[model samples]
Target: MCCALAVPLPVGTAAAIDDQQFNELKDLVTKLGQKIEKQDLRIEQLEKTHAQDAQVHAQDQKTHEQDQRKIQELQQKLEETQQAVSNVQTAAIAVPVEPLPRVPLDEATVNHNFSILGDAEFQYAKTSGQHGTFLFADFAPIFLYRGGEKVLFEAGFDFGLQNNAPNSPGATTTINLSFAQLDYLMNDYVTLVAGDMVLPLGTYSERTAGWLNKIPDDPLPRDLLPGAGVGAQLRGAVPLGESGKLINYSVWGVNGASSADGTGNADQLDLGGNVGLRSDNAVANLHGKPSGGARVGWFMPFKPHYDLELGLSGQSGEWDNAGQHLWSAGVLDASLHLGSTVEVKGEYIRSCYGSDDHGNVRPEGWWLQASYKLVGLNLDWPVINNLELVNRYDSIHDGLGTRTRRYTLGYIYYFSNTLLFEGGYEFLHSNDPTQKDQLIFQLSYGF
Candidate 1:
């Protein structure tokens, strides 16, 4: 009984143990299956993630290509716009325009670029010995240059009917060319001039042109001195010592006869010269500042004021009334102006004539004139630009003519500084009755 019981128990125990082992194995297999399913789910999830990543990368690549295409399009448009801008610039550059040519100045324009100006006067007068209506004109043109050089061209014409004797001959009308010259200015210190220039022998002769004379009749010494001749002149100024002083000198070579009435002889030469000195800071009323110095002058071939030649004029190569006559004269003059308004002048002349009949005739003459001008007269109207009341007294004695005394009362009406009308009443008492009392009127213009 014990053995049977033990065997059964053992079998039962073995069977129970086997069942437990089976159950554990089944449990482990189920757990392992669940694990495998979880692993499969994880693998699927990883595959989906990788697919999404690939799609996003493709989209990104497409977007990048589109951006590149846009960039290329922008670049092409930019190049096209640049070419359009260049074409527009070229079109602008191709426009046509009218060209202006530069012109050069010609000789005719240079010669006639300057203007000419002048004035004329006609006077009707009745005097004791001479009575007629006379026409006289003076023309002066000023030429200016860019280089500060200047030239003054001057000329004059005189026309009149002269009837010294009403019954002797019908009044004869004549025209005379009074003055012609050109003044060339090299500088303030020097000048060169040619043509009919005034004589430099005396102050009166220098200032006694017919159109611009303070006195109607010339001073006696001026009448005796040669007034005008065709000539070449050189004038200059030299400064003296430190006292503010200078000397002005003028030297000239001239024809013996008037330029209008010139003799054919070209070899005839008349020599003249003048020297003047003045103090420093001297002022001239008409000429502004002047070189200050005393003045001295000499001349030859003396004559009366008009149409009166009283010297022996001769030539070099002939004699016996066939050739030219030789003549010589000497003159000295001095003047001083204390101020602009006061002037004192004196002159002395010695003349010798050589003629076919008389070898040499010596004649000496002189004159002195002093004048005081009241300059500072202001008038209300333009009719009287500046009124100057002048008082002058002169006396002269000639070896061939009688002594003379003259007094002059003068009035000048100036329309401008350059335009003036002058009238004077003169009283003359001469040793000769033929040249007694005289009256004169004049109108003058200058620029």
Candidate 2:
């Protein structure tokens, strides 16, 4: 409803416009209108593209929501499955299972029930004014058999190489049965032993055999006693109280001493000749009397490896072919242990022989020995700690007319618990010219 008024041009402006100019201006307006229409079409196309993009975005958002819901549902299912698995595991742990059957243990068989043990030694000796030589090579083997729970059999053998004579050029090998015995445990406090048993004379023959002798030789007085006796013995120990103290005892009956040549001569006396057959073809005891011996010992322990022991032993029997003579022996032994470092022991032995020539011949001796271990110093040295110093004083009077005394200083080097190297120097004093000072070395092993 708007109206426009067109005013006539001025006289100068009208004159300036020609027909050609008018036509050119109309063409320029037509071209501008066409450009405006193209611009409008481009704007409409852009709007349509924007609309399509919005529709696609909406569809994508819906798909995303659906996917999110599916994910949450899957998470819920996973939690439920995990809880179910947890409950199953807990229930399984609470459940009980049956046990397997047990098999009975078998008894020990005899083939595997026995043990073998023993000792061996080698020695070198030199006396004054004499050449040093290898003294002896000795091997002792012990066999132990467990017959049953309450029965045992044990035997020991000694094999040695020695000179045939004092100045012999060759050696003689000897094999001797040291001891063979069967032990029957009568009860908790008693054992019965039979056969050639080691006589509990003074504990020396039993306790200091072979390598057990700290010195290379036995004590001079031990020669008076028989090492073993063909006998039956009853031995046992009794607890004094609960304070780790006890009393041990042994009683035995055996074939006693016999004449070496079926004679009553004192010089021909033999302590170990009663076990063999005689020239008279008599397989019997020459004295025709069984000897009896007994020993009682008291042991007191104040602490581990610290103890004192005192023992008294005696034996008597006829020793002549006429059975008119008798032999008797008595021994008193004592041992003291201050600790693992100090040890002292000794024995006094006395024996009487009733004979035709010498009347009642008496042979007696005593020996005292002490040892100290260097380990007591706690020096932290392996070699010095394994060393032990030993000393002994021994005296003996032969039933004849000879008396001898000896002092020995020794040292022991231990290569291991059961292997030892020992050396000693003896200072001798004796009435007999045959007795002389000596030096001895021994290598000993025990197993």
Candidate 3:
């Protein structure tokens, strides 16, 4: 039991207080005491609420820490996986591409940092209702070397023989070294190239090789570009967004073309000039000048298989001594892919040759190609599952009041990853009213 003690008031104050006033004062004190009790209860409720909030905050912090740790673990695992894959790839590329007998593909004894890849092709082509010629057309060997993570070198050569006389033993054999270039990886965004480099003038000269090209005949006025040139180049790839938007670009200064330089990949100047040309390879230097060229491309890829690419290229330079062959050219290319089953490709190019004799003769051409693959459709059948249907149209306006158009319907078969065979029936329509149709067949094997 507890007891409280109170001090007594003064005798005069107690006498002055009337009974009614005393009763009112007691009631007022009782109200004040009740308010104090209510305030204390409210303070206790607030303290409980604050304690609950602290517990919730602590729980949230623990969850966030756990998530961070998981992310770090996943990052470490991904890095380890990537490093393992790189090591395996490096070990494989060090072996010779074509090793000797009894040497397992995975355990070849030879160890080299360089490897070789090549394509062998044969073709038969002729005008419709005319004589056709068969020949072993091309042997292209590509050399690849990786000097370091940031340095690379590649070179390629094409050797072919054309037989014009089927009844005779004479055949014209042609051999050309396409490119011998050294690449220095400047950074993620730029690369430097020197030596006899492939010109980045158009999409075809760089991408359409014997191993992977879809068609046998190139578009008219294919001479709009040089196959290779002596030059230095700056090229790079630009990342546009995470959704697979990208841009690629190249710019270079090279030995320009002259009137003597024929069409694209057909440089006769390299053969005739005896200026100590190594292996009869010549670098053009018309009037002691260099040509400048640039190309830019935009690309986009979508999930589950769709892609689009568009590109533009242009070059300009002096061509001859008398300004008779000042040359300028431009090319535009586009490609579309859907699920690896269908593809549409096209290129348009215009070339201007300022010849003192022929004035400015601007030759323009465009070609469109489309292909559909049955293999990707999972036809489940035996023989024709790996077949593809292709079609192409080519139109030319030669500035010389001549126009030509060719339509081709073709079929391609893939016996294996290394073997491809294609055949086409072509229709040729010319303003000359004398041109005939043709049929073409080509086979290529890759190694």
Candidate 4:
């Protein structure tokens, strides 16, 4: 169809197509206003990071509740220090305190041996001349040995049972070997001590413990000394400064105790008067000469807890065995403690036998004892807190001077530290006028 014709022309054909669609609609409204300002700045940075994660989880739950209240106040102070150590272990007197800081023993490597200690006793006696004696009486067992800084040894044995008189149907029992010693040490002030010894003479036959005696015997000058002998001794100790004082010494040489004569089968432990030398632990020497002695002491310088001990001892032997007769002795002992609640012990012993034989025989003695401690009066009463209270006075003289005056009174109760119970009452009195005024009653149980 190649032939066309047009006519009208107005405004140059609509102003050039409306100025190119108005410049593309102004670039699509400036690209949606820059994408709504980048999505409002990413929603305000995610709401400030969710409020800083809820304020750091509330400060970690308040620091885990103050560390659980400091672990419940350290478990309630460890249960009140374990109930005060269970009330000081049931209390049977001993109260000091604080003693668990160890680390001490190093006596040059300490080699030990033996190490046993024992005690047993059960006795009852009644007198008014004789007749009421129950006996199982005594059993010891001591033994200790050490060999570190130079040797040491000690031994013990004793057993007794008797009847032959009070109801005499014959009972007489025996077993004895009451001390076998040996010590060497020759250093810190020397020490020697050999064989059967134990006559250090004073403190109730060598430093206490005849069942811990709160009385049920052991006070009448303990048989005028010489209760053990077969000896050889030197003993030691001397340290007098640092305020502890101390100066102890012993000297010996023995085989000395005598006076026996009921001869026949021979082994008796006093069926009245030392017949076979009382079953013999020592006490067998009768003649040849060889009795020696000495004891010197001092301790604790007055008061560091209040204690003091003083001693003096002596002996001379040969007491009848066909070689004539001669004997001698002297001892004076003392002990005093005050802070552990009173204690005063004493002894005076003076002996002689056939002083040159003018029909010879002389005897002498003395004693005193005291005790007190009702737990120092702070008593809350655990049976008076292990009680105590004791008293004794003694005398015995004869060899022709006669005299006999005894008096004892006692009470002990301990209950632990092994165990204890004792009771006593003696009374005697005599100047002879036919003599025979007695009254005794004792009961015991050591442990």
Candidate 5:
């Protein structure tokens, strides 16, 4: 085995098996192993890189979605805010402003003029004492106006006709100037009225003289208490306090007996005055609420129960043959209102002529009346809107004549506050042969 091993080896084969070949083989094997390990490491690293990249991309996508949602929400909020602002702007432009108060008419530029307003009333009567129908018409046109500061013109005409007789001279149709006067408003607190002016004895004679029968008609003392005569009057209001306390006064100088019916001399002068007080919560507290006032008066002619007048007069004009007579008269009036629906009014008056005169002269006489009103009644849709019912009672007593009592029932239907239809029935009773009971109807229009 030793000889074979020594002689049998090939030269190239032996040389190929030297140290360099062995070393080269070993190096190549090691390099191949290292390459395999490096390839495995590279693959693992690639997987880890891919996973990190995916996680990062997922996080970025989530952040982008959140940002998108936030942007959408902000856009929606902005849109809603713009809509609210737009609505506010629209409302601001839609509302309307209020108007200012109106100015009063200038009295300096005022025109003084006369106006005529009259109505004819017909009566059908069948009384216990008499049975007859009377047709009568009253035509009265008054002239009144404010002329500057010192001069005011007032005049009126009265025409009464009775249809009782066809051929007979119709009951001496009396035509006369009910009132003719020139008044001077001396100042805000005083005035002077002369010529045929209203006597300041009664409330009806002075306060309501301008519009007769526009309210209820007055009789006896109210109708004949020296209504118009040659007189001078002073009227004004005196304030007692800033609480709206006031004293209203009217003083007049009138022809006593000679001024009767505007036929006697304008010689003797009678004096009269009225005092009143007024107070209102509207003025006291400045709240513009409703208010009220009252008045009392005195006259030179002394009449019983008449606090207004006390006097003595001697006539020398037309009653020369007739003996002199003492005359007296007075009045008391009051008015009050509650809210818009209720009102209260009252008045009394008396006049007397001394017993020295013949049977023609009479004792004191007086009359009184009152009324109430209710407003707004709803019926159906629009059938009954504004409606009111009124009831009134009146009585008069004159010493020379009988006592008269009257009852009135009335209704008013209003198309508006200013326009309405008034209808009523009046029942009368008297103890005089010449006077008879009657039923009356009237239609009134006013503005």
Candidate 6:
């Protein structure tokens, strides 16, 4: 509008313009007014667009903050989840899981769990200046039961028939429970045994039981120790090296030696007594304290049929009903095998007992036995191969000025691994008049 006003009009027409020029000037002024109105509208529209753009920018900034908050929340949640997983893993490591139940055994397995094995013996005997006679018959059976994966139950019984007296019509029948025990395999090198177990005071009680003994009769010194005891024991063998050598050990606690007549009388001492009930209505094991014993042995094998074993064993405890006297015993045992058929074994036993009349008396004995299988000679003769030569020397002292010595020569004929015929002649010398030389024959079968 100012430019239009500033426009110079014709100088002569300034005071009194013509009608045609004045109308044209009015038209130009109206057009300029319309242009100014449009300019004002454009400026208002620009301001409105700027305000809308600023509002949009502020909204975008708010959205970006919300997104940042969401990401932070997600990261925190993830961290919490990871911690929870770690805690769960730790708990799993610390806790123990229950084992699965065992499957029941089938009928066949149950039947197979039980096994029976044993031996029977028939014997004839003759003593010096005495007529020969049938001595005794023995039937022994061993029962075995598999209780579990690591458990076993075993029992042995002996039934015997013998002459009661020198011309007596009545015969004697005796029954004995040798040993009944539960064995548990505690580990690779340990076993736990309980109940009436064979005492491991020496190797003879276990190794020479029943048909395993080549001799018809026990060694004289063996009567000094109890064969079995009611007790619990821990036993095992430990491998020594790679040469098949091992060390065996046993530790036991039991009702040991006790007075037969509840007295500390030396003459009335009984090795196989102290069981069941006494005359006084007292239970067995008259002594208040149980006895303790142990055996340790080393067995070394150089080759097949070539080996040596040495063992030391002992026991000690009170014996009398009053528990005033103590009894103790020690044993040293050794055995050697040479080649396939020559074997030698021996035992030295020493014992002491406190008696009221005798104070302390010491009894000692030793025995040595040897056998040679003729098959070891590589003889082509079958008869000779089936025959084995045996010899033994045994001595004993009763610790009361009574002593005995014996020498035995014997032969064993083996029909099979489980059947044998054994015969022997003994030469005996003794301070006691009752002991004399004897002849013995035995027919033994093991199944």
TM-score of each: 0.50, 0.74, 0.68, 0.28, 0.53, 0.74
Residue pairs with backbone overlap in model 2? none
lDDT of 5 by residue, 1-447 (tens): 898778876778888679788899999999999999999999999999999999999999999999999999999999999999999999988988677896766666767443444333333434445555544434566666766546778787776765546876546676767778887877777766666666555455554442234232445445435555454666666665554445566655544342222221222212211101113222121111111112333232122322232222111112211324434555556544444444344456555444332433443444444334443232454544455565656666766556776666655555655344455556677785565544443343332
lDDT of candidate 3 vs native?
0.79
Give the per-residue lDDT of model 6 (tens digit) for 1-447.
989999887877765667778899999999999999999999999999999999999999999999999999999999999999999999998999888998876544665789999999998999888998885568999999987778899999999886679977987899999999999999999999999899988899999867788888889998889999888999999999899999999999888888777889887666656655677797766778988999999999999989999999999888887888888999999999998789999999999999999999999999999999999888799999999999999999979998999999999999998899999999999989999889999999999
Better-scoring candidate (TM-score), 5 or 6: 6
Worst 10 residues of 2 by lDDT: 1-10
Q: What lDDT is reached at residue 60 by model 1? A: 100
Give per-residue CA lDDT, model 1, range 163-232, as digits (tens).
6576695656666655567777888888887776665655554454454555444666444446555557
Name every residue pair that clashes in candidate 4.
none
Candidate 4 — which residues are off by over 4 angstroms? 1-53, 57-185, 188-199, 204-233, 236-290, 293-315, 318-324, 328-352, 355-368, 379-390, 406-447
Clashing pairs in 3: 128-437, 223-264
Q: Could you give candidate 2's per-residue lDDT for residues 59-167 as a string of tens digits?
A: 9999999999999999999999999999999998999977889754344667576899998888898999999988667899999988877789999999998777887
- The Cα RMSD in angstroms, rounded to one decimal, for candidate 3 relative to the true structure is 18.3
**How close to the true structure is residue 357 of candidate 4, measured as C-alpha lDDT?**
28
Please, what are the lDDT tens digits per residue for candidate 3 over residues 280-381? 465434445667899999999987579999999998876664444566889999989888789998889898776544667788999899999888778778
State the lDDT at 220 in candidate 6. 92
Off by over 4 Å in 6: 1-109, 164-168, 276-284
Off by over 4 Å in 3: 1-111, 164-169, 261-284, 323-325, 432-435
State each model's CA lDDT, in order.
Answer: 0.54, 0.90, 0.79, 0.70, 0.51, 0.90
Tell me how many clashing residue pairs each candidate has: 13, 0, 2, 0, 12, 0
Candidate 4 residue-wise lDDT, 1-447, digit = tens: 334345446878898888888777767768887887888888888888878887787777777788788878888888888888877776734676776886765776664555778687776666666677666778887878786556788888987877677855877778888778889988889889888777877768666757777776676556655577776888888988888888898888776755455221112111113222345566544455666788888877566558887888877766555445556777888888888878888878877655332454556778888888898999688899787888888887755666778787777777776677777777767777554434333344443
Q: Is candidate 3 or candidate 5 better by lDDT?
A: 3
